[model samples]
Each structure stands twice: as C-alpha cells, then as structure tokens.
Target: MQDKDLPDIVDLVREMGAFGDGGRNRSPGNSNSGYGQGGEPQAKPAPGLPAQSQAAPDLPGHLEGLAARARTYVEAASSPNTRRAYAADWTHFTSWCRRQGLAPLPADPQVVGLYVTALAAGAADNAPGRAAPRSGGRKPHAVSTIERRLSALAWNYSQRGLTLDRKDRHIATVMAGIRNRHASPPRQKEALLPDDLIAMLETLDRGALRGLRDRAMLLIGFAGALRRSEIVGLDCGRDQTEDGRGWIEVLDGGLLVTLRGKTGWREVEIGRGSSDATCPVMALQTWLSLARIAHGPLFRRVTGHGKKVGSDRLNDQEIARLVKRAALAAGVRGDLPEGRRADLFAGHSLRAGLASSAEVEERHVQKQLGHASAEMTRKYQRRRDRFRINLTKAAGL
Candidate 1:
C-alpha cells in the first residue's frame, strides 16, 4: 500500500469496526471474530501506542505485514459458507469469460450485463449426463443468484483496486430491465408439518446406529430451527474453537442452543416434547448415549454396520442429503411428480416446520429461528404449503 492509502485502510478497518484494545495494551492475538466472539470495536485505537504503530506504519516490511493481517480480518468479515459461494461464483464467471475470450478480473460492465442476460436465458453449458437426478438439468439461474454473482464480481474487482461500476448505465440499466421483465411472486419451500416430520422419522432404521443419529438430527433441527450448517456445526462440548459455530446445553426445562448466525449470537430454547417418541431432547439423549459421543462434533460419520463412529464432523451438504433422503423415503410430497418431489424438501424444512406448526408466540418462534427481523420469521411461519395466495380470493372465490 502507498503511504497515502494508509488512511483508507484505517477507514476500512473502522468501517468493519475492528481494532484491538483501547490502545492501552496491544492484544497478543489479531483474530477478528465477526460473530459475537469478536467483541464489538467500540472505539478507535488510542494514539501513540506501540501496537497502533504496528498497525499503521508505512515501511515496506511493516506495510506488507499489516496488509496480510488486514486481509485475514477482511476474509473473516463473512461466514465461510458465503466466502465459498463467492469463490464458486467467481470461478463460474471466469470460466464463462474464458470461453468468450473476455477479461474477467477487471470485468467490463457490458460483459457483466451480457453474462446476466445469458443466465436469465438459461444459456448454460449443456453437459449431458451431468445433471443431478433431482434438478433434471441446469436451469436458468434465479435472479437472486445472478444478482449475487454480480455482487461477487464487483467485490472481487474492488479487492483488486478496480471499480465494477454497478451503478453505471451499462450494468445498472440491464439489471433493472431484467428485474422489471422477469418480476414474479416469490415461491417458498414446503414446510415440513409435524405429521410429515413423524412420517419422515419413521423411514429411518430405528434399530441401527445411523437411524438413531438421523432421528436425533431431525428432531434437534426442527426444535432448534437450526440451519443445515448449524445442525452439523454443533459440538458435544461447548464449541469454543474459532471455527465452531454453536453449542447446545441440556437444561431441565429444555435445551438451550447458543449459536452464532448471520445476525449474531442468539439463544434458542427448545422444550421437551410431551411424548418420549417425539421429544427432541429425548432423541438427542438417545443418540448421544448410543453413539458414545462425549466431545468434539455432535454428529459424525458411522461406518461398518455402525460399529465405528468417525471423529470428523458431518458437513452441511450431508444434512441436506439426509433430509432429502428421509423425505423421499417417507413420501412426504407423494402428490408431486417424482423429480419435483426431490426439489421440495431440504434441510430448511425442519426450520420451516417448527415455524409453521409450533403453537407459540410469534416472538418466541422468531427468537428460536434467530431471525434478525420479524419479517423473516413471518415469511417462514406463514406455511406456504397450507396457505393459498390467489388473486381471486379478493373476489370471494
């Protein structure tokens, strides 16, 4: 960084609101916990401290070191999943650009517009036999996804000290036109009703260890309103590591789930169910006791007729697959066409199930979901599966 860019760096850090200490003492560690773990930076570093000097010096060696640390903190500003998604988005954009002989890094706004047009037109590569069984083949990218891709492109350009000029006519007009032309009412995932959940649970093999694990996973996921990532990221012990997302405590009244989500840390209180067969807490206990999981990841891979449980934790995709497999086996959406059935149920169904079926105060439901806004809670809680939206309703249909 040039000496002149130091102030901009300071401003950027200030915007992220991360600086170690009040400048009274230099923190030994430079970790930035974007979650609640990273305590809010309430004030700027006090001037004249040696630590501040380390952060601000312009000498070649010092600048390089500071830049590296800054980069680390910048990357930490977002969740790992989001970073991965952005990286994948960038890769897709670059690959497309390569095919077209266009520069992707310092992307032209015109080219970006063209890319968005291609996406909306479903002009993706037709790789036969490469389609997932459920999705049939590559479909036109959703508007939300295309927009995110644009954002990723813009962010990457900015990181490289270049401007994407998303506001410029070349990009702005095309995106606006696309939105206007393609506007449609939003469609939501089908919420897993309580009965549907029970049916799904029955599909698992209760006699096997894997069945116990799946049963526990489904119950906890529904009760806690956990995201797929949160379900898998949990630890038996407190998730104290920097990467661990959340932890659960078995309490007398219910289980308390303290998780770090996009908004921040929020506590989800899940009470014991009336019946042992359906109780989330009981299922959790049954799974933990059977699996003999005392520490590390709560959910893990079981092998060799469930005799050995691997220490490694299950990934987010596993949760999605598990949900899909159970839902399919149970015929949760039997009325839907076979291929469409696969698209209907996913990890989010558990969360949506709790929101739609639970007879509780809205605030409690909202709190359990860790939603930053009441609107988001209502969106899931509305139960699109059962609720109908029709223009003729107003006409007394």
Candidate 2:
C-alpha cells in the first residue's frame, strides 16, 4: 500500500467505529466530547487516535539507550587501530569544514567532492587552524589515504543515522578523477634476508637485557612472520591480559605462538634453528630467563641503563625503530645513503624476510603467514623464485 493512503485508512477506520466506542452511549454535550461541565475546553484525545494509544513517557529514553548501545557495538566491530584512524580522519574532515564555514553533518555530496578535490590539490594541507600536514608543506595526500578518509566520513555519517551516497556523481566522479590524477605505485618495505638478519643481530650487545629482548623479538617476528603489534601484544601464556592479542609457549621442539590477528586466531610454529646463536626458540628462552618474565607481555621495556626490565608492554613503533637502527648499524644497504637506508626497513621487514627466504612450497609459506590466500603470501615474498615455472617456454614459443 502507498504510504500516503495510511492517514486516510486510519480516518476511515475511526469513522467506521473500529475502536468499538461509537459515541452512541454519550449525551449531546458529554465530557467525553473534550469539553468540561463548566463549558470550557478540556484535554482532547490524541487526534484521530484513542487516548490509550499514547506512548509511555519513558519510551523515548529507552529507545535512546538502545541507540547508544548500538553505537557501542558498531565501535567494537572494528579493531582499535582502525577505530583510531577513522576518528582522526573524521576530526580532520570536520576541522576542514570549520575552516570552510560549512556544516560537517548531513553530508552534502558537493561539499564532500570539494573536500576530496582540495585533498588532491593539497589545499587541505594548509587549511587554517588544522595541524600541519604530516608530510610538511602542501604535499598531497596519498590516494590510499584519501580513500580511507572517505570511508571514515561515510562511517561517521552512518553512526548518526544519516546516509552518505558515495555512489552519487559528485563523490564518485571526483574520486575517479583523483585516482586517475594522483594514484602512485605501492611502496613495499625492503625484505631482510637471513644473512642481513644475522648481520643486524650482530650489531646488538648480547649480554645486555635490552639486547636479549630485541634479539628474541627479531628472531620470533621473522620465524613466525608476525606483524609488529602481534610481536609486542603477546603474553607468556594465554588469557594473561585484557589487551593481549596472543600468547606463546616454550616446548622442547620449538616455540609455539598462538595469535589473534586480522584473520582471527592462528598458531605459528618457529622451530629451533641450526645453531644456538641463531635459534628463535633459544633466543626467546634466554630472554625470558634473563628478564625473569614468566607471565604478561612477552616483550617489555628495558629500564635503568638497559639492566632492568619494566612490567609494561612495549609499543609496536619500537619494532620499526629497532629494525631501522639495527639495519643502519649493520650497514645492510651500504650502497644507499644513511637516511634512505633507514627509511627502507621497518617491522614488516621481518615478516617479509621470512617470506622471501623460506625455500618451502608456496602453500606452506601461505599457511605459516596465516594468509587466507596464496596471493597475499606471495606479496610478502619480495625475492621469490620468479622464473621457477618457466610458463613462457612451456607454452611452446
């Protein structure tokens, strides 16, 4: 039925005495007719509806509570890092809107299109009252970053029960134009091979508490192909902390790491290396023994001149810094300038290092990396045997 017909239908129902109070029992000037005995107007029944149909006083508050809970659930649906990025993106967009003297809400497609255009032109970088852009003066944002910001805006609108039509011509056409004009090739981190890893390891002071912890982290991260967050978020055992993302167990055979990653729960097996100096399992055990770390986060802060360990968990950014420092110290990429070499290595270098070095089958590598598809694992294999299949020759040239 058409929505416009609803009010007419209700009026008809009321006229037909569907409510079973046909007014036949009332007098010509009864109080039920919305008039007092003193001939003054009394409170009228709700228009075209019975008085019993009125909503309870608390119903609005109850619905608001449900809405608040729904918002909480939506926030919980994303990882903490994702939520944080989205929040920052929204704040940036809103700050830009303020500078432009526009409303951020109700999501006008034209305004959004203009906003993205400014991002592409680098105008948004210098928008007044906003913090200086991370890249310094007037550098346009990456296409990936622009796309993420758009997603953040859409999600923010949805949380407020508003619709943002990303498919609208204003948004879609501008985004397409931006992509055509500004998209660049993805920059992958330099993969650290086994030799390079050994060299980096050699740069550390093995006797120091910090050195042992860092050594264990690097080895475990490489062997397990673990992301930086997963490296530091791990506990000595399962269910140790509310924020812990995974845990590890030391066994006679190897080190078993159970992690809750983007793809959910998975186990990584890092077997004992050929030598005690290089074994990931041995390094972890040594670090644990020296640090007296029986529980809580596997990696932690080394305080008091690198002699004492702190109870707090280590930050993920430290992984990147450590990798860079060690890479520079070991002169892994001596051909490049010091600044360029430092920029090439990061936490992901360890994961990519293992992927590029493992001589096993593709499926084994994929499984070990906890990648749902072989294609994803291959992306991490920076130095894979590309010509192994010889598909061109096999096709009968």
Candidate 2 Cα outliers beyond 4 Å, as residue runs: 1-76, 127-137, 389-397
Best model per lDDT? 2
**Which regions in candidate 1 have their CA more than 4 angstroms from the true location?**
1-72, 124-139, 239-242, 382-397
Candidate 1 global lDDT:
0.72
Per-residue CA lDDT of model 1 for 1-397, tens digit only, reads 1221112343344333344334333232332211111222112321111122133222243345676677567666776677667656766775666566565544478888878877766664433223223465566777887789999877655644458889978889988987887766666777898999899989999888899999999999998989998988887667455557788899999888887787887888888999999999999888889889888788889998788888888888988899899999999889989799988888888898899988878888888888878888989975633545565887898
- Please report the TM-score between candidate 2 and the true structure: 0.79
Count clashing residue pairs in model 1.
Answer: 0
